[model samples]
Target chain A: MLSRPDFHALIKENRVHSSLYYDERVFQEELENIWYKTWVYVGHVSEVPKKNDYVTKAIGPTPILMVHDRHGNISLLQNKCPHRGNQLCAYQKGNRTSFTCPYHAWTFANSGELVGLAFPDGYEGVDKSEFSLGKVPRIAIYRGLVFGSFAKEGPSLEEHLGDAKRALDQMLDNSPEGELELTAGFLQHRTKANWKFVLENETDGYHPGSVHGSIFQVASSPVPALYKPESLALTRDYGNGHTEFDLRPQWRHVGKPMYWFNTTAEKLPLYTEAMKKAYGEQRSQEIMIDGSPHIMIFPNLFIAEIQMFVIQPVSVNETIQHVTALQFKGAPDFNRRLRQQTMGSVGPAGFLLADDTEMYERNHRGALINNPEWIVLTRGEKRETRDEDGHRIGHSTDEVTQRGIWRHYLKLMTEQA
Target chain B: MIDENEIDPSIAEPVALSPEQELMLRRIEQFLYYEARLQDLHAYDAWESLWTDDAIYWIPANGENPDPETQMSYVYDNRSRIGVRIKQLKTGKRHTQTPRSQLARIISNIEFIAQNGDEFEVRANAFIYEDSLRGETTWAARNEYRLRLVDNKLKLVRKKVVLVNNNKPIYTLSFLV
Candidate 1:
């Protein structure tokens, strides 16, 4: 085990030790301190909308089942059966009143109650209450998105989210009904890179033009204003490792019709008309101009360009990225456009994302070099400003957001185990 | 969602090919063989030019799904997106392509699934062997091509690649499958 001082030495304000990415000891420390303790996005309530609907997902190393109970409450249960530690839920998703373990025929209710056991007479003195599938320590939901924390106590999900709530609201408020769904299935990509690489790259503004230059050059549509830093988009560190690439305040006053940002009145006639009717013209205009803020919800969640990316660390150098393109429940045309836009940039073969995967692997390889002790995180330190919400806002071309992430990471990683 | 009306009526079902159609099959097999060669050689421009102006190159995620608008896909590109992708590959700045993929593929089981006026739906299976800095990836796929003969030259209107492991978590699909 690394001492607290050793953990503290691994991170600094302008640079972090490369061992943070390559060291198995550091990786194990993260799994225990960060992954198990923090609030991690497990699944959305929309996934299991009705009674008995369930899906098996992983929050770090623990496999869990997110199921809607008979009372319509969503519960997170360890997918492992209490009997003999067998995996209980084998399928990815299904509707079932009870799950029967294939190995021991131990039956668990949708609510995670141990209702049946093979040869109960042989284990007459066993307490059924003690053998129920273990429940996750806590679960929190915001705007239909569910998050699970393995720690018995910590800050509430709301506190952890901080000013990142605005981005979630934007995602939900884009729909007239103020709801979004994951009707569109996920695009899963397993890459040979550290989980932190995905977290940093998602909010990194310095790489778009260089890393995704080919995509930018080839897009027939007008480039997204966020990609053009001259437009003055801000990368804000909301603390708690949550940060957002804010497009709203920058483009709020751009007073011209821009098609990519959806400000043009004639660009999407049917969808625009629907939005206007549902949200009124003024609010519709705001939603359009604000565009969608690229958000990193610390540790695991990422909402960028209309897709939700959940980073799952498989090993020291392996990460599985699950991306779900969201849909507006009431707006089919708008949802279709969102899906198209998201598909263009994310997923396994996305023109923009495929390049990023390559970069992550290469970056991981480079971090393995023992000579380079530190990876630079300094970019726009001098230009930092505090927004009204007390979040640190930096230039779009800066690495301020990464610094924010490491601050919380260093704090969490160094805490007494 | 793909407009069902926009889809060629012939691909709606399988049909028998006539003698002349059978001859066209021989040419298609040759076309597919060289198309694979162009990709293996990293001749992106030549490979891209093989497509018609209104082409749809798709690799659906989570099994075969007809609706690209609502369903996720590995690669769902229109002609413009395809152009941008090829442009990126050509820039030689895409770091992932550095020491570009050493790829070779075997195309087999070519058959005419259906035919309509001036259009044909062809299906084939392939085993693509790829090697890069990361490691080797063996990709086996069911390749479905929507072709049109323009001025006696075959033009690709669509290429739908269905990988055997379509629903699983995949590594970087930087190269064409």
Candidate 2:
């Protein structure tokens, strides 16, 4: 293990060594400390909608089977049979009352409690009751989203989320019923990139203009080349490794802006209009257009309410992004079709996302180059910083948010739990 | 083989083709075939013009449901969304279009299901093959089309595609199916 001084010295410079990306030692340490200790998102509560419904997900290197129990509670357990360490639950998702191991006929309930063993005579003195599928150390839910932590003790889920919960609230509040549910299915993609690259890409406003230039040109006519600095909202160094980019209404004119605001300033009437009527004009406007851009909940969650992109990281470098084209559950069919058309473009295979993924792959490959010692995130370095709700603001094109992520990453990697 | 007139209604219906109805059906078939050909040939601009200003395109998420509002969908595009996509495809900076996607489509079972004045509904079956950096992916589906005659020209009002494997994991769907 590297000494504390050496680790602190490397992190203090705010630049990470390239070896960290490919090193097995660093990967193992992150699994032990970061992945296991932090409250990691373990799929959404809406995924396993019914009793016995289950989906397989990975937390770091560990494969976890997430299931909905009889009482509608979510449980995360090791996807391994204790009897012979055989891999259980081969299917990605299904409704099963019990999982019977193929090797020895060991049965486990949907709750992951071992209920049966094939041979009782073989273990004459050994107790079968002592053996059960290993459960995650901590499981918690916040506003219907489920999360799990392998650590025995740490900050509560709410405490760990900190101000990030506000983003979650805004997402759920957008729904007419004041609750957001996962769409029927998800779009899964396997990309060659570090997991952090995925998180950084989601909130990195600076890249949309350059990296996705082809998409912008193809999607927009007489492409608007002017970059209005005032229209972009940049905030860096949010507590607990969080960063947010709030694009101004003007910035929405980039390619095809969301229906929330159009060229005529006509806002798409939302499902929560009653709340708007009750709150009056000022509060209603704030709630309606308070923040339209993407918000990154540090570590792994990227919530893009405008385009309907919800990304969940599966590994240190691999991510499983679930893109849902959301529509008001009770809305009219016409309105729903309209919403789907606008929202569907953000999926993994859509035109916009195709370009975005290409850039992500390029970045991943570029980072692996032998020459460069640091990936410069020094855009808009001289911009003034303004504070708002524990966030520091910079130009929309600034790399301040990326720096914020790096700072938090250093803190997590260097901190002693 | 049984005679055409002796066929059962449940198994098959009388193949009727009226002059005007035949013309309309032919136009609809050409519209769908041309649209598919454009996408297959990577002619995005030509493919985009098949829709009217208010045309709606949908690929329903649930295999059994015809409604797209309550259930999710894979691809839904309108005028603005389609315009944005066209722009993205034409943009020189798109890296995913590096090698560009090569596609071929097979369309069959063209028939006019319903008609009312200048408005008509047509249905067909399609099989699309797409090859790109990710690899080649095949999609087979049935399609329902609603068209309206505006200014003496056929324009799409709605196009609903029902994929046989609608519930399966979709590979990259970078272009129109």
Candidate 3:
């Protein structure tokens, strides 16, 4: 285990120690201090919209089963049989009024109540109420999004979200109904990189030109060059480690045809007509012109325009990302275009994300080398300006978001437990 | 904006092939072998020329779904996008291709499912082995091809790849798999 002084020495104002990327001790500490104590996104209400619907998820190293019970309430329960610590829910997802433990025929109700146990006379004094599934310490829902935390006392979900709520609303409000639901399935993938690398790559605007250079070059259509100085985009560091790159402000008023090549003018008639009908002309036009930005709600959840990323840390060096593409229920044409655009960019065999696999793997390999003690993150520091909410704002092609991540990371890591 | 009807509906009803049709099937099998070889050798130009102007290359996700519009796919490239992908593979700074993946694959179980005019619907099973600096991975899939004879040459109209483990998480599928 690293001592307090050793951890302090690893992180500095302009650089972070390379060991943070590959150290097993650091990984464990991160799960305990960060993931366990913070509100982690589990799933959306739309995932389990009806009674008995459930989805199995993980928070750091612990598996959690989120289910909608018969009384129309959602509960996050530890996926373990209280009798012998055996796993109860063996499936990823299904509709079940009661889950029977395959080990000993111990059954639990969908609402997490202990309903039955085989050969009950053998365990006479055990109280069924005390032996029910263990619920997470704290659970809350903001809009349709669900989150759970292990810490008994801390900031509420809204308090933790803070100014980042605006970004979440922007995505949901794009739907004329002011709501959205996840599609049928998700793209679950594992990569050879730390979870933080995934978060940093998602919010970092400086690397797109180099990392995905081939994608823009061969796209054969008008795609925004994120690295260009004239792009006029900016990174906003909403306090509490939540950050985003704001592209909407840059493209909303431009009036140029900025739609992705796949979502062409010819395909927009039906969807545009539907949007106009639902939200009227002005709001529909505004939604159409604005470009969606990537928003990271520190540690676990990442919300892009049409897709959502759920980060699960497997170890110090490996992470699993769950990619869910959101679909508007009412608009079939728009949903079709949205699915195509998302798949082309971030799907498993996508034009953009496939290019990132090599870079992430190489980064982890380099981190294992002991020679370089620090990785610099000092880009665009001097020109950064503070907003009214005290968030640091820098140009689109700057490392401002990375700095913001480290700033909050240091605070959480160094605080006395 | 493609009509769903244009898609080759899966033909479960197998028909007996005449001697001429069998010869055509043999030639189509040869064409598939050559196409796979070109991709393995990184012969981008030769591979690009095998497709017609309106060709479609698709890889469905979460199992095979008939509709590409409603369900997401791993790859949904039209003719122009296919050209762009070829150009991307040849670029000097493609990090994924810096130490490119070495691939070898086997195509088997060839069956002529259906035919319409000059276009023939064929089905086959494939297993691709990819080796790179990161690691080695084997991908198995069902391949459905829509081949048309244009000017005495077999030009690809559409190719749909259905992976066996489409519902599970996968690593980088950057190559032509």
Candidate 4:
């Protein structure tokens, strides 16, 4: 166990030791105090569309089964069969009215209720009512996304979201029907780095120009009129460790040095015309020509205003990110296709994203050597902080957002449970 | 020029052709082969040029339809979008592309589906293997090609790829499959 003094010192300094990434002790602490205690995003409500549909996932090593009951309420339950401690659901996802454990034929309702048990003669002396499936203490939903917390007491989901709710609203507001549906599949990728490293990259704005320079060069070379930088806005310090970077108009232009997406007038017309047909001229123009922001909900969820990326920490040094593209509940098919194309650039197998994964691996490899002291989070220090919708804004290249995340991280890590 | 009426009917029914039809098909095939070769060689720019000024590249997410307007696709690209992807691939700072995506494509099973005046539709199959820093990834799909012939030259109207496993979880699709 780490001494309280050591923890306080680390927090007061506003930085964490490199060991936090690889130390089993710190990993365990994070599992208990952070992941299990906070409302961690499990999956979108669209994942379990039908009654009795269930999917399995891991929240900091704890296997959980998310099921939609007959009444359509989604519940998170421990994947264990209360009888003899056997795992109940074996598959990744499937539709079944009831789950019968292969070990003992102990049957459970889709709602996690113990419905049947075999060999009544062997259990005559025991009470079957006491062996109900253990439910995740708290399960909540914010804008169609489901989250589960093991701790029975803590902040409410909205309270925990704090100022980050705006980012969530950004995603929900984009849908014409005021609802977003998680597209059919996901892009899953595993990385050899501390999960925090992967999670932090989602909101880090400083790396784009430098790290993706080649991409910018190619995108800008033939179509210099496409790429622009001024239109991008990087916002840091939404309370509770959340940060967001809005890269829209400026980043959409074709030939400027920056991230992916060609922001050319020629290309805009194609999307604009399609959008106008689907959503009417004004609304279609707004949805297509104007780019969306990427939101990083502190600790784990990376909601890209239009898409969703969930980062799951597998081990002290392993992480898995699940990328899901979302469609407006009733948007035109062409718009969905356009969204999918943009999403593909960021998906696990995307040109831009695959490069990011390699960078993470390289960073992890570099961090493992000879005890590197610190990974720099100091960029755009001279820029003034502007307030926008309850967020602190900086230049597109600013690292202040990353600093904000580390600050909240230190606070969470130092607090006593 | 080879007469459309003289062509074999077993492969596909013969349709009326202007004097430029045979030349157009040859040019279109050349463009298709060249694009496939570029992707196989990881030359994104050369591959991107097979499209017309207003063309679309699609990989359907589900269903048998090749339309990009109404269905979700693995990849949906216009010229600008494809340009951005090429830039991303060429960027040295791209962590995922550090080792670069090495690819090989086996394209076959070509057949003409439809044609009207300058616009035509062709179908084919593609098996692509892409390797990067992570590992090797494989994709196989039936493709639908919509081309417009102008002045005896072929330009892409749409290239729709239907992956055998479009609904399954995919790692990433950085390059054209």
Candidate 5:
């Protein structure tokens, strides 16, 4: 029997034990207590735009598929064939009228209705409803992103999203049509690091200067400026393990819009015109200045400004990231720029991201070393404070987000125990 | 950003050519070898100089079916972006390339696929073996290049790298493919 360590002690106010990155038992418990029990993001609704469109993904080790059925409903279906344990749909993404298991030829409608099976004479007494594909107990959609939970009950998606909903709101409002198209394919990156490294790195605003100074030096980036102490950009702890690098203050400092893109409205005249036409001139300007989010939703999803990331955990020391360009519908010109920028700044070969990945691998290696056994995270805790909405806000280059994430994580790991 | 309707020089079928055309191919073959050498040596400046002003260096994601305008690509650098890539490499601060990965590449099967006046299309095979602190990573790709003769010297206008495992998860593409 594995002994349990107090997660509260492991996760302190200003530091976290390095063992969290290497403990297999802890990783398994995380999958059971959090990933399986709580709502896990599966895929975006934009990914399954039409009926019969389906994409396969995994929640922890269990394979699941997201499908848009004939009834214009989006739902989650277990990818396992009820007859035996063969994988039902193997392809990454495709249009499928029905899922037919290759081993036993068990055919099911796209809506998880088991239509028939090969050699049915032997199974004439079996009930089709009982043999149909299993589904996640709960499926929720919030602002086009799909989430599935295996547990029968917990917080609703709206309640789980909580303050984090603002991030998605800002992201969607960037588009004049107030809709997004994630048709741009995924760029998957394999990492030899713990899944927690990805979550920690998402809002660790301090590392950009040290880790990504090279790329920023060459390009006229607004990121370096935001890290300055005097800069108005704030790092926020949105509670529930969600965190953000809120650059809105610096973006709005000029009292004008389009600073996030570092371009004038004149440059993207067509997009600007559409924005004004859709949401009126004043609202359009505010939306442009507010820009998109650089936020990490608890456990897996990240709305990293120009791109979106879905972090998938494999083991204690292995993880994979699915990255895609954030596309705005009815804004071809802006989408074109965003697509080109995403190619340069993300993925495995990305100028900024490659260096960060280096840190991820190195961080894992460092954690393995027998040391003080703790990773010091005492960056800006002294200056951190809460806002009117109860969000813990700190300097852009602060560790308040880290502390907040650990706080929420401690609550989940202990309460559910 | 490729046009599906038009005949792409890089992917065209190879045909038997005249002896005179073979001589022209020999010169282009030499340029390919020279280009490969610079990449292996991490010669950023010299390698960058091989491009024309209106050049494109692209690496298509998902095996080249969908165009870059529709589906995302690994790299879709147009002239200036290519310059930024090289500039970042030279900055001595790219942690991914700080202790740059030692690379050795082999280019083979030079196919003279198409010709259009001063422009020529060539297809070749490349296997790049990289030895880094992390471990060894081998990258294999089909190199499709569109070369233009500027002042009687071959200059790269476009180079498309189509990796075999584009559809699958890739470990590290921090270095040149």
Candidate 6:
């Protein structure tokens, strides 16, 4: 087994070793340290809005069932029956008042309550209270986004989020009702690469100019040429592996309302009026001008401007990314456009993400070789500055975001060991 | 067969098409074959040439509902967006299709589901194979095509491809598939 000092050597001050990407022993260590010992984004409440709604999910290979019970409380229960360790919920998602194991028919309430056993005579002196579904210990929600941590002790969700909370607040405030919905179905993008590549690419301000050059040339996207080194945009690394591509700095130049959607406030009079009434004209105008955030919360969640991505690490060399368009509760007129924009940008067949997937897969292949022993993370370190909030800020095309991710990864991986 | 005399009135027998109608059917099948050939060869420009001005291309998501306005789909493009797709593919920098995948597909079980004057609805089973740097991937789908005859040419109005792997996660589908 690799020791704490070995981890420090592998993940250096500014460069990470190639073995970190494909080493089986390192992968197992990550599952123990990074995946199990951190706060991971589970899902959203809007995904299971009604009582009796349940969705099966996983946290580092541990099966979890998030269900809205009879009392409308969402509980994170293990999808396994306490008896014989059989998996209780089989379906990905559904509506159910209670769950019954298909193997032995042991029934339990959707709220992690052990209502009854199949046949009481099968075992004597078996305490029904001892057999309730196992709870995931730590569950928290901030602005309707649900998160669960496998570790019982650590930073609370609010503390772990820190300044990164601004990203979620920006998205929620983008809605006139100060609420966001994620009812839109996912566009799953399964790629052959390390899961960290997804998070690294999420806040990557450098690759857009080169990796997605073709789409920029063909279409008039808001991101066209906005990712260059001289662009006014800033790549920020908030602590805890949380990072952001804060385009608001550059967008301040235009200051046009709803420019992110390539539409004017005049085109969306309904949304304009709703926003004006909701937060008054001045703040609404600012919200419209600033637009949505493109940021990544460490471990799994990425709020990609208009869409949300959940990165699932299947193995050392495989990953599954699920993306869904963000839907506002009261913004009915504008939700359709968000869906269209999401389909156009991020899915498997997306004009931009398809090329990105190619780059990531190519990185995975190159990481397997022994030629280059290290992956450099020293692009803009010399000139990088700090914001008032202590965020490490770099020019648009810099390695500040990636360095931040690695720094946080090293901390989590080594501290636990 | 003694049709009218021996058959019961409740039974509806299939009628033979006129020679002119048969010829039109043959032409329609040939047009479908030509379209598929263009896609396999990665002749994006020519493949796009088969579409009319008001083309609608949609690939619905996991559910039975194929509505683009409500449910999320893999690809939903109007005529203008379709033009954008073709433009991106031809930009010579799209790495997903950098060298272009060697594609071959087979289409069978063709049937005309509906027809209204010059417009017709056609459905067929499709099996497509693509090979690239990532190796081979086979895709199976039911192709739903809406075609219209304009100036004696069969032009595509809409297309909906429901893939067998629609519900599960798959790799990059950058090509015509």
For each model in turn, which proportion of the native inter-chain contacts is also found?
0.72, 0.42, 0.62, 0.40, 0.66, 0.71
TM-score of chain A of each: 0.95, 0.85, 0.95, 0.86, 0.98, 0.97
lDDT of 5 at A228: 74
Indicate the docking level reached by candidate 1: acceptable
Question: A214, model 4: CA deviation in Å?
Answer: 3.8
Which of the predicted structures, 2 or 3, would earn the higher TM-score when compared with the native? 3
**Candidate 5 positional error at B111, Å:** 1.2
Query: Which residues of candidate 6, in runs, are more than 4 Å off?
Result: A1-5, A61-63, B1-24
Flag clash pairs in model 3.
Answer: none
lDDT of 2 by residue, B63-159 (tens): 5353465445666666777777677677655567766878899999987877878888887899988777656778899888899999988888888
lDDT by residue (tens digit), candidate 6, A204-298: 88898888999889887678656875789898999999999898987778899999778899988888899999999899999998999988999
**Candidate 5 chain B worst ten-residue window by lDDT:** B1-10
Candidate 3 has an fnat equal to 0.62
lDDT tens digits by residue: candidate 1, B8-78: 43444556778998898999999999899988898888999999999999998876555676788888889
Q: Which predicted model would earn the best TM-score?
A: 5
Ranking by DockQ: 5, 1, 3, 6, 2, 4
| Candidate 5 ranges with C-alpha deviation above 4 Å | B1-13
Query: Candidate 1, clashing residue pairs?
Result: none
C-alpha RMSD between model 5 and the true structure = 2.7
- Model 1: per-residue Cα lDDT at residue A308: 87
What would the per-residue lDDT of candidate 4 be over residues A143-231, giving only the tens digit for each residue? 78888888898889899898778667656645556577764555566677788787778777666666656665654432122222454
Kindly report the TM-score of the first chain in candidate 1.
Answer: 0.95
Model 3 achieves a DockQ score of 0.38
lDDT by residue for model 5 (A144-183), tens: 8899888898889888889889889999999998888898
Query: DockQ winner among the candidates?
Result: 5
Error of 2 at A220 (Å): 8.0
Each candidate's number of clashing pairs is 0, 10, 0, 26, 0, 0
Q: Which stretches in model 3 have alpha-carbon errors above 4 Å?
A: A1-5, A220-225, A256-267, A273-281, B1-18, B64-67, B112-119
Report the Cα lDDT for residue B39, model 5: 86
User: DockQ scores for all the models shown?
Assistant: 0.44, 0.22, 0.38, 0.18, 0.49, 0.37
